[model samples]
Every structure is written in C-alpha cells, then in structure tokens.
Target: MGMEHSILVRVITTIMPALVRKEIQDETDRITGKSKQISPIPIHLSIFSTNDIAQTPYYDFLILPVVNLTLIDLPGLTNVAVEGQPESVVKDIEKMVRTYIDKPNSIILAISPANQDIATSDAMKLSREVDPSGERTFGVLTKLDLMDKGTNALDVLEGRAYRLQHPWVGIVNRSQADINKNTGLSFARRREREYFATSPDYGHLASKMGSEYLAKLLSQHLESVIKAKIPGIILLINKGIDEMESELDHLGRPVAVDAGAQLYTILELCRAFDRIYKEHLDGGRPGGDRIYGVFDNQLPAALRKLPFDMHLSLQNVKKIVSEADGYQPHLIAPEQGYRRLIDGSLKYFRGPAEASVDEVNRVLKALVMESIRETEAMVSG
Candidate 1:
C-alpha cells in the first residue's frame, strides 16, 4: 500500500511541474508580444482523491497556451444541504472563482451537485448572476460510464442546453485490466495499486504538496534564465602610479626636481588616457566609446594648457588623474544615470580645495546626462 501511494504521489509531482512550466511559457509569450491569450487560471491541484466523486484516473494531460484570464467557480458537492442553499452556493462559488482566477472579466462555474434538480437550480442561479454582467458561465457536471445520455436528459428538463460528459471523458481513458494485460504486470506490480487504494488521504495531500513544490521550482528556474540572459558590465581603471614610484627611487633629488622623470610620467599618463579612450570608443564594447567620448570632450581648457615639456610637478600629475577619475559618463543614462551623476558630483565638489580633475569629472557627468536626455527626446519624438 505504501509503495502504491508513493507511485501515485510521484505521478502527481511529475505532472504538476509540467503544468507550472506551461504557465510560465504562456506568460513569457504574452510579455514578448507573441501571443494574445492570457490565462487567468490559478495554478491548482485537481483533487481527484475525494470519495464524494468516483476516482477517475487521468491518462493524458493537454497543455494549453495563453488565454484571457477568466474566473472559474468550482462547487464542491457533498451530503450537506439546506432549503435556501442554491443562492448561497452560487455566491460562494462566484467568490471562490474570482479569488482563484484573480480576474474580473470572464467567469466559468464547474458544478457537481447531489441530484439533477439541485444541479439545475445551481446552474440557473450561476447563469442569472453572470448574465447581467454579459459574461458566459459554463457548468460542467460529470458522471460515470454514461456520457451524453445524462446531459441530454438534463437539457430536455431545463429547457436549456447543458453539455454533460464523464470527468475523464475528454481524456483518453484506459482500464486497469487493459494496462495489466498489455504490460504483463507481475504479482508485485498488481499489489502496488491495491496498496495505494488503502491510503486515501495520501494522494490528496501529495497533490497539494506537488502543486506548491512546482510553483517554487518554476519561480527559481525563471529567475535564473532571466539573469543568465542579461549580465552586468564592470569597468576597472588604474593609473600607473606604482611604476612612477620605482623610477623616483633611482633619482636622488628627493624624487621632486627630476624634470626628465616628470616628463616621462606625464607622457605615460597621456598614453594611458589615450589607450583607455580608444579602447572604449573603437573597441566594440557595448556603450563603450559613446561613454568614453563624453569624458574626453569634457576635459577643461585649463587642464589642456599643461605643457608636455616634461617639467610638470607631482602635484600636476596627481591633479590630472584625480580629475579624470571624477568623469563618470555611465551615470547619465536614466534614473541610474542621474544617481551616478549626483553621487559623483557631490564627491568631486564637496571639499574646500577642488582638484581640477574632480571639476572636469563633475562637468562631464552633467553633460552626459544632458546628451542622453536630448537623444531620448529625439527618439521619442
């Protein structure tokens, strides 16, 4: 019995994941403009273990694409009954459907009542309630063995058409005898099904647990897939300050009065800037050159006046690199852009003595934002 219950639980677990994947695929299609169908169906486990309804094994499952989200009222039929119960059932069914589907547009009621008379009253109340709203409600009542005969009988008495079929009538049905005969199930295999039948609640709880498990699995998979497709870019910049320290060590003039060494440092600095700029612009990095160009153009005229005669001081070189560091064009792209600009600007301008490099970086960031806004306007227009 335990083994049979395990097999049944496994089947539910396997099926629920597929259903969840289908829902995710449908949602993705709608977002990408490929499909118009939107399904309002809440992910749920169809509890087939209930004893009130005959257990009908499902052989095949059909996956549906996106469809408009619709409300579905599912009425549970047990022994409980009252004289004024039809209206209450109708209202409860409607509320349940709305909550389950989470859609206000279309509503469908799947009802199973104790008898034909009660089923008819329930259907009528459901139809009338939804009729004024101009939404169609389908009442599906299922029975065993007999298919269209029951539906036809109800149709004639109600003076309205009601489609009746077996619960698993739409699904391909096969008998246990047929399965056993075809597969040549041994004594051990037959015992499994018999064992599973003993534990009724096992199947029900497993189905609910399977649904929750699938929901979590699908959520995680979707998040991973999305993250893999879109990745963040990181850019690292380093000035050659370490190399200069080695050269200064060989010079005996307190590393300050060596004009030739200073000249070399300035040349190296200029080369580093040029290489970075060119790599960003012509190297085919995404948003690379466009971003680098903003900083390049924003260099102040006063900084450009620095002599390349190799006589510049350590203070000058430090000032140049510091100013360049402040240039952050990437921050001007959108909301992120504004935040980067504001942060960079505050950092560059907050001190009593502003470095020339910091001023240049701040101005460049502002210009980048302005340029982005203008470009956006042109595209939007």
Candidate 2:
C-alpha cells in the first residue's frame, strides 16, 4: 500500500487547510488501526480554507469566507502498458483525464517528479492536450530532494524548458522509507519545510515550495476564476428565463376547470351570437353598413306573407287620392286597366326590393360567422 498511501497523503496534504488538517490526521489514524476493515472508504477529501482580509482584537473577517476544495484521485498515467495490465487500461486512464479536464471552468494541477524531465512527462502532456494555452494548468514539481547529485529543476521552475503561464512550485514528497518507518505526517511536513529552507538549490524557492504554499496558490486561482465567470453565469441564467417565457406564451394560460365550465363558456358565446342575429335580422341594422357581397339564398317565406292583392290596391288608391287633378271618375275600373297598372308597379319595384333584402341577410350572416370564429378561439384557449 506504499503507492496508495503516498497518493492519499499528497492529495490530503495539499487540499486540507491548516485548521482542518488535524481532523484528517485523526481520521487516518483511526482507519489504519486494528479495525481497518470498518473504516469508511474515502472517495475524495473535502478541505475548507479561509483567508482573512481584515483582523481586529475580537475576531477576523474572511475575504473568501469559506472555500471548499475537493480533490479526486484518479489512476496514474503510464506511457507503456504494464505486463499484467491490458493496453486498454492505459488508454482508459488517458480518456478519463481528457474528459475531466475538458470541462469549461476546470483547472488542472499537473504533478511531476523533479528527477524526470517535465517536457516528456505524461501528466504534463495530458494537461497540454486539454488546456492548449496553459492558462488553466499549474505545475507542481515533487520529490525535489530525490534529484540526482548536481541535477536540479531550476530551469523547469523558471520555465526555460517548458513555458507555463504559472511558475512551477517545488515540493519534497515523503519517501517509501518514511512510510515503512511509519513516520508521522507532521514530522514529514517539517522535514519537507527544512529540506527547502536548508538546501542551496531549492533554498531560493523556500517561500513558493511545500503543500501549504501550494494550497494558498490554488485557493487564489480558484477565487480569480469564480470572479471572472460571475457575469457570464448571470447572462446564461437570464437567457434561460427569456426562453422559458416565450415557451409559456405559446402554451397560453390554463382555464379549463370542469365539463360544466366548458359548457357554460360555449353557451355564453352562443348568447352573444343570438344578440347579433336579432339586431341585424329583425331590426334591419345592416351590420356595419358594409353592403358588398353575393347572396344565393332566396328571401324567407315570412317576408312573402304580406297580403299582396289588398296591400297593392290600397297603395294604388292612396296614390290616386294624392295625385287627383279635379274630378274622380275612374271609379268604373276595367280588369286590364288595373292589371296594367299593378304589373308596371311590380316591374319597377321587385328587383330593388329583393336586392336590398339579400344584401341585409348577407351582412347579418357575416356577423354571425365572425362571432362563431371568436368562440372557437376562446374554447381552444
């Protein structure tokens, strides 16, 4: 479990703030005891770090009140497939890394041993594949104390070999011997701090080395990313709201309550049509005076119920009385004479009278049809 313990310690040490590291250390001790099987399986470690922007005698106020950083441990990358491991395993790990780092707001921390040339490291290559500009990737040079004699990563840290936007940070990793000896993490951390401070090559980078410094650097980067993305996040939210509103407009409002409500609505619409029918058909209102259209239907039988012969004779008598010259001697009337007068009057008046009736009926029909269309719209709604 040497590799496993090393991986876990690296992640926990980097993620946990000074305030929460003790809790994790206690948990680790509990797990490694005689009852190791009952220990909770850790997926990722959550570490809380707070930076104070102001401090007084009473209390300190944090600039970033609380930043929770979660570190996920993935399988290490390998250039060549191992003897027992299938070639697909290596490819699968690479695919996983690519998928994770491709997320829009993701930042990659590429950890490499200082003894190896970072230019050829699989971790550094994966970082570049996902973040071509190197803007979202930070380098952590580990195992600095294990470098070959007369060899150092000063050039790599300074970005002479590979140009990284963020300068590389150096850290001394706990050795296999340290784990075999069961050295406490606190002792290991102090050893790391002393190694950087005393070593001539890495002494210059003392302030920028070690896990605590690395954690602070990551926190600052995370805060910067959050600040930069706030406006864009709000813009996306507003855009979503507008799209939802348009969809609601197309959907319209809900009004159907029950079968009876629907029936009442339909009846109310019919009543409005009834009022229009009475106004145009009985009152002869001529519906908006738009008298232009064709009418094929004949006048109703009720219109022809007028007493033709008696009404015509009365009208003729009134006309004669009104147009009398002096004497009234046409009392002795002939059948053909009455027929000629009546026929002439009918010929002059019939066409215009029928046309006027048809026109009025057409306007009334249009009004009724319009009312029906409006009712359909309401029912559909």
Q: Identify the leading candidate in terms of TM-score.
A: 2
Q: Give the alpha-carbon lDDT of every model.
A: 0.39, 0.68
Can you tell me which runs of candidate 1 are displaced by over 4 Å?
1-8, 11-94, 101-109, 112-120, 127-136, 141-381
Using Cα atoms with residue i matched to residue i, what is each candidate's TM-score against the true structure?
0.24, 0.54
For all candidates, what are the clash counts?
A: 11, 0
User: Model 2 over residues 50-106: C-alpha lDDT tens digits?
Assistant: 332556677654333244555654557766766555567667667766766788677
Q: Worst 10-residue stretch by lDDT in candidate 2? A: 1-10
Give model 1's TM-score versus the native structure: 0.24
Write one digit per residue (lDDT tens) for candidate 1, span 174-248.
Answer: 245645454333442344334323434223323212223333543554456447545431111123455565555
The RMSD (Cα, Å) of candidate 1 is 26.1
